[model samples]
Target: MSAGEFYYDQKVLENHLISLVPFNQDLHVSKLIHEVNTHDLLKYIPFPPFESEEEFIKNFWEPVLNAPGECLYAIIDKATAKESGESNAFAGTMALTSTSKENAVTEIGILIFPAFQRTHVATNAAGLLLQYTLDPPSAGGLGLRRVEWKCHSENAASRRAALRMGFEFEGIARWHRICPVGVSVEALEKRNGTKGEQRGRHTAIFSITWDEWDEKRPKIVALMERKY
Candidate 1:
């Protein structure tokens, strides 16, 4: 893909706590790499830490940006402007990935830097993306029918967060993916894959369909708006 090419039409999404903007590698890679490296944020995603910035760009940024339906979003916190000497800090990333127009489906992936993890950033970011991804045309959203959230079955926190964000659990897929042996993944009886010289994990699947959006969206909005 060329430097300026971007696929997703909707570029900026905002709420009370965050602004989710299309991620620009040139502008965001530096701060993002530093935070990911220092905080080791990808442990749950199970991707090993990048060896270098070039490696991060090539391995992480390139593939996601080049994919037709995928887009990375930088989660910018609306608070603490002067402390960071900016309007908003690069709090983390939220991505809409594995999109399918035919199926009208997409998945949301989140990584909240340690500094912003336990606060309202993750909730607000996920809430905004949900509203944008599933709302109908009359509501000025993508009008997609389904949005998914999947995580390693052993990652209890992730599954809880998914449920909290209004994604309904759809059962576990045993040995759903092959991952490295020691990337913070806990072993389970169903995950015994070693053929590829890597371990596997059961995947916990969750989704919210358009039919359920009217009911779910308000709950998520309330969570996002609730003051800490």
Candidate 2:
């Protein structure tokens, strides 16, 4: 299924450096596989490292993209596209998940391909989505009241990234989830108290609410507009 009502019908978002397109399996799957052919790059996230497209489709594609109030977008880099001869640069993927139309809320998840991790792709792409999801509908945006960023509490880099994008730290949820062993790479509990196949994940939640958007938006814009 496509995205639920919480997300507007719009399909594409772009800026000078990056473009966010709803992921299409037929068009994007192969490219995604090519970019992240190895499983090591995905060890930090949940699920096993898939070696084949079938595994990826079964473990990732269906579980994520087919869920209610969730939609995935491919982050395309124009600079890479120009260098490679491909139509667009396939940098990584991000998603709008846990959406609620009634509450006007959504959560974002992002995964940057290994090659594109330390550069401008992540910031610029994140800025574009934040802009689209929080801006008023009259401004051709979603008018969402809240945009959340949730990640493993042990993943300090993730928390920092969210803060960099204007998401304020809300606090941690202890034993927030039961993750399969090896899946919770950032789980400090793995080496501490947790045992057996199931490990507990401490989740860190962050958010940018509508009330704070006016003040935060400009700061994010300035970060995005800076020359790399």
Candidate 3:
């Protein structure tokens, strides 16, 4: 199989709690811009907080849109409805990138808004993504052999979430990449005469192989399917 074969006709994955659908720029971009501007949710992420809608598009959405072999999905809370007086149902975004068809591997990256954190939203969204990635093609899965979860080592919350979702801690990459200073941190430091510091961010890598998923799938399914 080729990369295109795996990504072709990317499907919508959903459960009782959340829905993972292919991100639509027109519909999602504005919502994302509002969320980013209103909250400091993107602080731990590599990119700086988006100051405007265009910056959000050029810096975040456009890259994912143009990246070949990458599938990005908007995380929607199934419980929320526009008629309920909300501007949008979107909660965050998750992605599968660095996919290798011959090797049957891909990496999962996620960003959940502050409003949705600590709920079952992240776990169920992850479970749905995992289900779609590991299940066989005939059964509507990506048929992947390995799925990776990598995060900044300093991100303890992310590490905990990965372990809870059944991804095993593999190892850490030191000085993995350069990341911008978060808005809050930068602001506090600027008040003390320091600013514009980009630092090396260490990354912790975790993974769930096909066999591991086979063992863990039932438990995850039960967890996601249970009343929330």
Candidate 4:
């Protein structure tokens, strides 16, 4: 994706809005950062938030709001056709980090509202995120060479979703993560340069290359049609 264009601009975020049934203001493109800082919706994921929404906005989201290599989006539920509900902040976000020599690798993770979990919302939203990451810039995409899906080794739902979406099995990273812990509390007692000591439980990595994606696209599309 070009620096100014969001997520390769291969597909306009606006276009996705058209597919959102009944239209929810929470999913509006303008409220992206606000949506992300809404901790109420993000409790599903392991990431810890700052003390308040304002704190999160100032300390985190705002800093990276214009940064390259990361793109986050709100998920819309077209199937439910419900116009009124909790605002759909970031059901999930994707990271497309720069890798070797002009190649960028993408990683995706999602957190669906409890009501929307296991429904078509996750599948459809993830599908779009994948396609957006892998599509060529000329076609309005990030043109990534590889896309990854990693999760805590024991997170079965995440693993299942990775396989379902076509990420191939890759080895695990032992003790790579731990369950959520309070960063602020730990920082107070710890000396400088020990920040890295904070850890999470084990994590498993899974990946799919563009070549693999091309091969699996037709099948995945078919499966999605049947399941969704």
The candidate that wins on lDDT is 1
lDDT of each residue in 1-228, candidate 4, tens digit only: 122223443233423221322112234433433444554543324464555545545654556444554444545554333465434433434333333325677567665655566666666666666666776778766677888887777677788888888888888887564444321122312556655554445667888787776787776666556553
Looking at model 1, residue 195 earns an lDDT score of 42
CA displacement after TM-score superposition, residue 187 of candidate 2 (Å)? 10
RMSD of 2: 3.3
The models' CA-based lDDT, in order, is: 0.79, 0.78, 0.76, 0.55
Q: Record all residue pairs in model 2 with backbone atoms less than 3 Å apart, i.e. clashing.
A: none
The order by descending lDDT is: 1, 2, 3, 4
Least accurate 10 contiguous residues by lDDT in model 3:
181-190
Model 3 local distance difference test score: 0.76
Count of clashing residue pairs in every prediction: 0, 0, 0, 7
Tens digits of per-residue lDDT for model 3, 66-127: 56667778898877743453346688988888777778899888988887887778889999
72-114: candidate 2 lDDT, tens digit per residue: 8889888898788444578888888878888999988888888
RMSD of each: 3.2, 3.3, 4.9, 5.9
Each model's TM-score, in the order given? Answer: 0.88, 0.86, 0.84, 0.68
